[model samples]
Target: MKKILIIGIVASGKTTFAKRLSQKFSLPWYELDSIVHHNTATGRYKRSAEEQFEIIKEIDIKGAWIFEGTDRDSYQCLYQMADTIIFLDTPLWKRKVRILTRFIKQKLGIEKCHYKPDIMMLKMMYKWTRDFEQSRNSFDAKLNRYNEKVIRLRDSNNLDVTKGTRLS
Candidate 1:
């Protein structure tokens, strides 16, 4: 409830959920991508793992926070510190639709992203969305070892961050 970590595949609505949760709970929110993918004059580039860990450590020391991202490896420390973990188990079809829509939005300059949108990025996103099942299996395995309360949200429509309720 205090320190929350949200993990899921690309376009799984992690950012949206985190924003809603942050507003509802009045907790600070951080997006891991913004930390890892530092915007530069040449575009976005990932920070070194050591640097990323250092930044994450700073965030982990905070009293309360809600973080969203898929960097379980670099942010393992934060994962350990979080009190609740939310895994968005959204359907692949829905995720695909979201990916396409978001890509279009970014291309049209209507939506801003941590990284610039390009053909290669779009292709990578599609591949990532397609391979989500495997990634989720790995994520679940890692989470199985953690004792924190984990919430798996399968349907976006069922999620109510304000009330922390899930409708069937």
Candidate 2:
């Protein structure tokens, strides 16, 4: 798709899938994280809601992009800009394993992670998904009006959000 939006829970592989899609489609890839946040000490984006909105508003105006993120930000501006939404609803256990595994790799210097992992950081990551801090569920009720626009994937290993399930 020319204008695709990739969304999912933290550690659900949304970013990885988005990059793959970009390669497949041969289109420009845009990371919401890059535009919406500043790097923390450990190379993690320091989130700022206002900044995110401003950036998304500008980016949406540009149109024609493949944006990726897990946060269910109700930027009607951003949603209207996207032609399709891909929701990656990976299982909880898999998500945890992905997080822990990445943490271990980063800690061991086997692989570089975008963020640092400490006990508190791990707790935040767990909470991020559980509380829908950066997920589709956060905008479930509000986006109900836009069911026609959504592509909900409640279960992992689904073909498509529309075929898999409807959030509202």
lDDT of each: 0.79, 0.69
1-168: candidate 1 lDDT, tens digit per residue: 899888888888889888887887899999988887888888778898899888877877768899898755776877678888887877788888998899999999999877769989999998877676757666677777763466778764545534332322
TM-score of 1: 0.87
Quote each prediction's TM-score.
0.87, 0.74
Model 2 stretches astray by more than 4 angstroms: 40-54, 72-76, 133-138, 154-168
Candidate 2 local lDDT, 44-117, one digit each (tens): 56556777777777766775678888654444455667777766767788898988887788788998755566
RMSD of 1: 3.1
Cα error, candidate 2, residue 74 (Å): 7.7
Clashing pairs in 2: none
Instruction: Name the best candidate (by TM-score).
Output: 1
